[model samples]
Target chain A: MSRFSFNQITAKPWTLPEMVAGCVAAGVDQVALWREPVAEYGLDRAAALVRDAGLRVTTLCRSGFFQLPGWFDDNRRAIDEAAALRAPVLVLVSGGLPEGSRDLAGAREHVADAIGRLVPDAAAAGVTLAVEPLHPMYAADRCVISTWDQALAIAERHPAEHVGVTVDTYHLWWDDTVLEKIARAGDRIAIYQLADWITPLPAGVLTGRGLPGDGCIDMRAFHDAVDKAGYRGPIEVEVMNADLWERPGRDVLAATMTSFERSFRGR
Target chain B: MSRFSFNQITAKPWTLPEMVAGCVAAGVDQVALWREPVAEYGLDRAAALVRDAGLRVTTLCRSGFFQLPGWFDDNRRAIDEAAALRAPVLVLVSGGLPEGSRDLAGAREHVADAIGRLVPDAAAAGVTLAVEPLHPMYAADRCVISTWDQALAIAERHPAEHVGVTVDTYHLWWDDTVLEKIARAGDRIAIYQLADWITPLPAGVLTGRGLPGDGCIDMRAFHDAVDKAGYRGPIEVEVMNADLWERPGRDVLAATMTSFERSFRGR
Candidate 1:
């Protein structure tokens, strides 16, 4: 059997250390660390303790922007931090369209150029930059990579070991060619993540996500396809919903494990 | 410039005849006719009067099954109706994923098979089949084809000279490959529909579309690509805002024309 990782979207209540412990307790063997938790503790110490914990660090939470200033330097710094942690993938979500620009094509170009400048640092750090295409509802303020073909094309343009894509079903279940793209992406895929899609989206992006089976997503088929696509890497449960973050850490991790198992049953 | 047909999503106050007349008055030369309005006026008479008005019918509003019995036969009847109207395209929106099945892949397979069976009939009548991939949020209860690639695959399955994909911005603006697919589709794209995506989706999908320039879409860049892609078709302004429908019919059409012009900036 293959191992999987789970990332806690928030580090509140029990802190990152406690969440890490909680995930271990829940039978999860790997983790993708986020930025806030690293910020709370100094990076070196956090890396040391995680190494001591006997758990694997699969990927770093993120770094990307279409409209933010100082993004380039910030991204370089993020690569150093990820390198320190020994994580292989750094998630890159291209921030929303620029203010008053109304030019999505321009925004996409900005993201490409930013990646072009930063991929060298990431490559040196031995980290793969994974461009994450967020849901279309988030096109305004979240991310511009909304489909797999676009993500694949971007990754293909870079064509390096350090540049690839993270395919998350929550963000991509609604896309048309997701399965086709997954099969085509083959080994260049960086991360395979899962979250559920729920309606009446809570009036905010951060809180609308549901646990794997709590909502409408058919995660079993997704995992099956990912496995079929030759992606044998960790299937990370990356739930960003504020509701899940607010829940008891142990219960949340336990429930997510159950959902993950259910999603991949005999797939 | 070539004259084109328009599809007014809501035809209130003015009645069907007057709506067609209003579109013609506003320089629209053809139309994508919906079945409900014609049913309200009775079919044979509606057909005769529409034919008499010298307005070309571009597409029929819809025909598919979310979870109904006899879905194939029902949609076959819709194809027959399109034939009667001598419409160039029959818009087939794959019914929503069934209530019990979260199997989106299964739903897509059903859609492809149904279209496969109907392609011969569609070809015999000289009616092209345009598969409309709805917005993802509608996956639960509307059409399941949510990207250009998916629609293209479905079109490939049928391979009828008359089968192609319909690109509606309201349903597809969130996609990353809109320009690429529009260009790649070349002659296979029979229709390109338009609507602006605004936040707080007005509580339901039946309405809540914005006027072209009122939303955040990069309409002009999209325009340049579509034009550069060699699509010299008429820009069909199809808005489904409740607020717009509540206004005077003349007011809605007038505003849509103004927004359409602004959206493309007369390029």
Candidate 2:
């Protein structure tokens, strides 16, 4: 439970203050936050609230849609926000192909180059730019980086402190070879997020993630891999399920803690 | 056009006789067939219908649910049907995790062993068992095999004439390493298929594929890779789209042909 961090997406409706209070009541020491809610609640205020509540911000959820018009400015702002919040990492979900484009290879190249451009700013902010490879199902509209190899390739191009791969089990568990490669990743692993892969994925494939033990993923394999990679960081339970979001934040946090114990400790 | 084969799923509602006749009228020389409708239309009659129409059967749709009971016998029956239709290839989609099993590695091993057990029968029927790596979205419930490397690894275990890999652009387009690997695959390429990856995938995700030029896959890249691999087999369009299914069979065939020409011939 000490390593467990409750990602804010697990309870979608919970505001920053409510979430902080709920996590405090549930005895969660850390959280992974999304950019939208943080921006909505005012980044500095949200940061102060979490800090005052004695909760560590594990990561800031994303700012890397390179295909968009103002990606450069947006990512820079995200880096600033992460620094202000004292979050060590900012997750980057490289956006999918530009509209009407069939150039996936080109899109990937642009991601690497875009991340390279952000490396200096991220380094200056003392935040790791965690390149997250979303599931291949999202390759068209969400993220072109759909494998650990792709994320690692881009990350290896820069200093490990500035850029590293985000290992999310939901996006990567289908890969048979990823576990072994992840074990060898060493300091290149930025943040490890857990969300089990469940079937009958809803339209858009976004909010269909399962709680750790509710799905078929062998969480032991991921835990062992991350451990072998020498990553000593908070493991965030970042499930995004419609059903889970309907529950109270405290209940969701409790269930998340239980899932973490069952998946990580195999209780 | 001599190399173009219309896979029956592109026109789901078309009967075997109608599909064969439609192919003939459209100057199509080959087709890839599914097992269900063929069985419904009477295997012998379906075979005769295609044979009489001078339409060569490029490959039989599939038969490799190794996780299920009687997979061996079912695959053998499929092999016999392929033999009856004079189809040179039998595409295999290795079934997902058994009922509640979380051992993906174990499931993959079972697939390899199951295929090994069926290789002799497939070889005797002069049919190449083409292992298809489905998109990873289907890895949990539909197919365990989810990458070019996984499919190739299994295929390399048997004689190239007996077992080979199916290269479908829809399943493998997101893989950056696959194009170069496919170029070096040589005769291990049994069947080459095309279906573009479209956005906003519907529930279940089984029928969300786009026609060749309708989505973001670089079709020419795939064509070049297969050609570089020295493959001379027929190319099949195997899209499964809900929107496409609502149209008349002839219109679907025409639209599919147009997509193929635009994607392969490039205007």
Candidate 3:
């Protein structure tokens, strides 16, 4: 339980204060936060709220999208936000292909270059930029980095403290070689996230993830791999499902905890 | 135009006779046939219809759902049908994880073993079993084999003449190393398919693919890679869009051909 963290996106409608209170009430001492709600609640206020409640911010949800305009400034701002919140990691979902482009290889090269340019800011802010490889289904619009190898390659280009990979079960369970690769990744795994892969993916293919034990992913396998890599950091449950979001935040957190326990059952 | 083969599923509403006639009318002398419609039209008649139309059957659309109850016998029947139609290749979409199972590695191993079991029958039928690695999006309920490397690995274990990989642009395009891997695949390239990857994937995540040039896949890149691999074979434009299925057979074929030409324009 000490290693469990509830990513705020798992309960999308929860206000920052409400989420903080709910975490404290539920005996959860750690959380992973997204930028939007944190900004809406006022970054300093949100940071103070979590800190006063004695909750650790495991990560600042995201900051990459290098394909978008002003990404450089936007990401630097994100780095500042992570620093302000005292979060040690900022997740990076490398944006999809530049608009109207079929040059995937070029797009990928740009992401690596973009990350290199941001390493200095990350190092200064003391925020490790965790490059997350989204599922291949999102290679076009949501994210271009679509494999663990791709993320690790980019991360290997920089110091481990400034850059590392996010190992999310939902995005990577399909790859046969991912487990062994994750095991070998060692300290390069900045943050380990949990979400299960569900079938009949909804339109847009986003917000369809399952809770850890609700779908086909072998959660224990991922747990074992992460353990083998010597990662003792918080394990975040970062599921995004429309149905789960419709429920009350407390219920969502409870369900997430239940699923996490089930996933690690007998471990 | 000489290399063009319209996969039958592109015009789902077209009867086998109508499809064969439409292909002939469009000056397309090659086709890839699906088993359901062929069985519906009566396999022998469907075979004779295409053969009589002077159409070369490039591949029999599919036959590997190894996780299904009667896959062994069913696949053998499909191989026989492909032989009857004189299609040199039978594409295999290795079925998803076994019912309610999270053991992806075990499932994948089973697929390899199942294919090994089918290799003798395939060799005897003079059919190359084309193992298609579906997009990882389909890894849950469709095909567990979801990468060019996995397909190639399995194909390499068998005689190339008896087993090979299906290179579909939509499936492999997201892979950074796919182009080079395909380029070195040589004779393991059994069938080269083209379908662009369009976003906002509809429910079920199937039947939403785009025509060659309508989406982000670089078809010309695939063409260059296959050419580098020395594969001089039918290039099947195998797109399965719900909207496309609603169009007339002739219109779909014409649109596919136009997209194909546009994809290779200036090449």
Quick one: best TM-score, which candidate? 3
Better of 2 and 3 by TM-score: 3
Select the stronger candidate by TM-score from 1 and 2: 2
lDDT agreement with native, every candidate: 0.76, 0.93, 0.94
User: Taking the tens digit of each residue's C-alpha lDDT, what string does model 3 give over A1-267?
Assistant: 889999999999999999999999999999999999999999999989999999999999898999998999999999999999999999999999999998888999999999999999999989999999999989999899999999999999998999999999999999999999999998999999999988878988888999998899999999999999999999999999999999999999999999988888878
- How do the residues B123-172 of candidate 1 rate in per-residue lDDT, one tens digit apiece? 88888888888887777667788777788888877664678888788787
Ranking the candidates on DockQ from highest down gives: 3, 2, 1
RMSD of 2: 1.1
Flag the better candidate by DockQ, 1 or 3: 3
For model 1, the local distance difference test gives 0.76
Measured with C-alpha atoms, the lDDT of residue B247 in candidate 3 is 91
Q: What TM-scores does chain A show, candidate by candidate in order?
A: 0.95, 0.98, 0.99
On residues A26-115, what C-alpha lDDT tens digit does candidate 1 reach at each position?
656688888768878889988987887877888888888747988988899888988999998899988987776667767877888888
Candidate with best DockQ: 3
TM-score between model 1 and native = 0.82
**What DockQ results for candidate 1?**
0.29
| Poorest stretch of ten by lDDT in candidate 2 chain A | A258-267
